[model samples]
Target: MIPNVLTIAGTDPTGGAGIQADLKAFSANGAYGMSVVTAVVAQNTRGVGSIVAMEPEFVAEQIAAVFEDVRVDAVKIGMVANADIADAIRQSLDTYAQCPVVLDPVMVAKSGDHLMQQDDVEAIRERLVPRATLITPNLPEASVLLDRDVEMSSLEEMHASLEELRALGSQWVLLKGGHLGGEESIDILTGHETVELTAPRVDTINDHGTGCTLSAAIAALLPRHGYIDAVRQAKKYLTAALRHADELDVGAGHGPVHHFHALWNNAPLQLQGAQR
Candidate 1:
């Protein structure tokens, strides 16, 4: 069976982040993509202007609607703005717990605008984090979860944060190092094992939906590959996207990664957004 990946996230009208990016990432990683929108964000590569969250009951209904008919291979959760949505997702996910869940703890936008409520942090930690097969967090998110100042300037710090984040609950934790400026970007993965993946930093201003893309890619690959192989493949795909991100020329500020770089540029079938 083809792996069908589901993304539960907010919407970005600009189409670089949120549900849009998840869809692109899933498609790029060879999976059929589906989405349940949690919020409609009035934002762009520059920053978030405003957000309108979906009702808790409605979000729960969307989850039910999808799970009832579709055999989801994996679930990627992002940008659940409030406690109600968090609770709704956690409660609804119980029926689909057999499918692996990849949680991308998206608390803020790349432009530093807070996308999640401060009060909802505990709810996510208590409810959603435990159920997650894998949790991917950057330095700031890990710091918020641990309630401490985590400076991820060094590999040692990244590993420590990984351990602390794993303690909060998650079968595995991936601490992303993109936030830390270095010649090489390193991401630390811990749980069943401690592994560090590093890649040369791609200097570009286009990284709007990176976190969502990486987590979604992981989910997309899980149904077909081993945990380590999936993560490795995701890293390779993300790196290529980052390297060619400038070609998109999306906005004046940060743009999106070239998610369909291979498909639209060099593959046998030249699949564009609508065509896919």
Candidate 2:
């Protein structure tokens, strides 16, 4: 049977971030995607207007419903809206303790909407981070986790953040450097091995779901590849998605990365983006 990947995240009406983007990335990487939404967001390319969080009981029920029959090869988690939701997910995930979990701490949106509460932050750091096989955090989210400001502008800072992130309970940590100013976007991976993956920064305002795309890609690839290879391949996928981001004019504000750009294009760069 084909690998079945699961994403436990919130809803995105814009289809760029959260479960929408997660499913797209999983399918793009050749995985059968499943989702359990923790929230229904009233959002668009412009920004998040409001959110209706799912009840903790329903979240647990959804997870049970999926695991009872389907065999999930990997799991990606995003945007736990509150402490109750976090606890519910953690308890449900405990039943399937052996599965590799990809945790993307979705604290804020591209347009600067706070997706998580302060209490949820503590809950994730204590509950979910320990269970995650891999934790992908951007600079702002990393800062919140470590309780200190994190800047990845310098290679030294990147390495430092990677170490601290691992210490926070993730078996491995991927610190995304897209927010750092540079000619290239660099991501640092630390835990099993320390390596830096860099890609030429795509000049576009339509990178609404880049983070979700990347973490979901890693989750999809982890069933077939080691951490390093999975991260490398995911980086390549994200770069291509970003390169072709302008192809889809989804909204007036920050749009989404083209998740299926590789499947559609099959151009040389689609495979060679991460290496360059």
Model 2 per-residue lDDT tens digits across residues 215-245:
9999999999999999999999999999999
TM-scores, all candidates, are 0.95, 0.94
How many collisions per candidate? 0, 0
Clashing pairs in 1: none
lDDT per prediction? 0.89, 0.90
- For model 1, residues 192-270, the per-residue Cα lDDT tens digits are 9988898899999998899998999999999998777788889889999999898787987789999998877775554
Specify the highest-lDDT model's number: 2
Q: Each candidate's root-mean-square deviation in Å?
A: 2.9, 5.6
Scored against the true structure, residue 89 in model 1 reaches a CA lDDT of 97
What would the TM-score be for candidate 2 when compared with the true structure? 0.94
